[model samples]
Target: MRNVVLAHALARDLNVSAAVIAAFADAPNFHTAHRVRSSGSELLPGPGKPLITPLSYQSIIAMTQSLSRQASDWGDLAAWVNRKIEHVLLKPRHKLRNHI
Candidate 1:
């Protein structure tokens, strides 16, 4: 179950396709799985609620979009930091060489 969730999250973050995510999660019937509801409520009544409900397609898509945005933001931040670091480290060397 945790693996399925992680696979889904990674798929979102990495921009992987639904088929790939499903394969990674070992859920061959991924498309139909979400539509399935627990039948326990019908048979056992009251206390037999499902512990884990399947994620809807809309929720999955929303999650993927959110993760993609976050990844893009992080990538932008990393690029900015790399440029700053390069400027700081290289500028001093250039200054020292000029003074030499």
Candidate 2:
């Protein structure tokens, strides 16, 4: 949705390919900081032909939930929460990976 909205806005402002806009729309998960930082990419213009930025969809939800609760807080259910949250957070990505 973020990607879609950005692509729509960029397409409205810039006369570029829909695919290019679509690609930019998915930068968080499709790219890495190393790739974006190693050098400028398709996001740059003028002589940069293959303007591509990688997306790396960092997961904050699980991390936040984990940090919100501590070992003492979990008491006897730490293991259960760990397994359950891990599964919930990873399920979509796992499916995506499998599908891909």
Candidate 3:
């Protein structure tokens, strides 16, 4: 969802073709829904306590590599994505540190 929004922004800013932006926004078939499990014990956990499982470190690495490859295939879109990622990651921390 967020990726779609970013793709639109990139399309407008970079003058990317709509077809390419659509391709970039499409998720790879490997992507799947997060699994849900009981919050505590498997058998004795309280009701209404489902927890969404987080992606493993290896999964994160694989997804990052896949995205990198996809971005690279898009040429200039790759640079735009990297800049957006850096800005999103660093801007908040810098603002927080300044406030502190």
Candidate 4:
């Protein structure tokens, strides 16, 4: 499932758990929510910032499963994911390359 794959990615990168992922997935936008704000992560969405949210669990599941089924190019997938998380997980250019 797409959510499962995403959950794994989030858990690995953000150091969270299944419950946390589920809670986040259940949110309206997965960012513009009180719980996400309280999460204290740089990934938090704020005014003027918006994030794509899956329309349904089934959709996410179908998406991720499709990726796997299609044997999607891992390099391309990694590039896409990097674009999404680098800003929130990695350090700024001036901070030196000591990844977070």
Candidate 5:
């Protein structure tokens, strides 16, 4: 699935260091969290700074699945949340973004 596609892409681009490829392929959020910390955090970090940990990865996956289930449970309430977001003070930004 996504892992296969990403590994295929990395293999095509980076010819050396299967360790690097495997690490990248395993945790998709490593790249994203790195980007955020490097730009948005108080301390800017290099890309090589280890952003992925066993606990953090577990938390990310757990939270993702939980949020997905919540959205499904909510049904059109998710849609309503998105529509009314701008009106609320300090709105819940983690609410789903329905692109449509």
Candidate 6:
């Protein structure tokens, strides 16, 4: 496994025991383990954390597909402009409300 190879290389390079190298590799996990403090606050995830949102991912894919299918003609451009104007005008109140 990659961990074993890395531990071996680190052990050789740093002139430390394999157990020490393995401990070093696991230091982050050890520090970040989920345990409540006396003050009742939890530590937030740091670097190398991945979060997934399925609906957001699907919405982006759909938007890309829809935009790619729009025609390059002048009429299509005008319609697109009108739609943008309507969205900007009609949705300003809702957008500002959401932000506030």
Alpha-carbon RMSD of each model: 20.0, 10.1, 15.2, 15.7, 14.4, 18.4
The C-alpha local distance difference test score for the whole of candidate 3 amounts to 0.38
Model 5 lDDT per residue over 36-83, tens place = 345532221235442222233334444555778565545554344434
Q: Candidate 2 vs candidate 6: which has greater lDDT?
A: 2
- TM-scores, all models, native as reference: 0.25, 0.21, 0.23, 0.23, 0.19, 0.21
lDDT of 5: 0.38
In model 6, which runs have C-alpha deviations exceeding 4 angstroms? 1-72, 94-100
Model 5: runs farther than 4 Å from truth? 1-38, 42-47, 50-71, 74-77, 80-84, 89-100
Q: lDDT tens string, model 2, 1-100?
A: 4664576578658977433421222222323333454654445433544334443222223334467755454443445544544554456665644422
Stretches > 4 Å off in candidate 4: 1-62, 66-69, 91-100
Report the candidate with higher TM-score, 1 versus 5: 1
The superposed Cα distance between candidate 2 and the true structure at residue 100, in angstroms, equals 17
Residue 3 lDDT (model 1): 57
Worst lDDT window (10 residues) for model 1?
19-28
Which prediction has the highest lDDT against the true structure?
4
lDDT of 4 by residue, 1-100 (tens): 4765675578669965432233222223234343545653333234543223323333444466567855455445545544544454444555523332
Candidate 1: segments with Cα more than 4 A from true spot: 1-69, 94-100
Alpha-carbon deviation at 20 in model 6, angstroms: 67
Better of 2 and 4 by TM-score: 4
Better of 1 and 3 by lDDT: 1
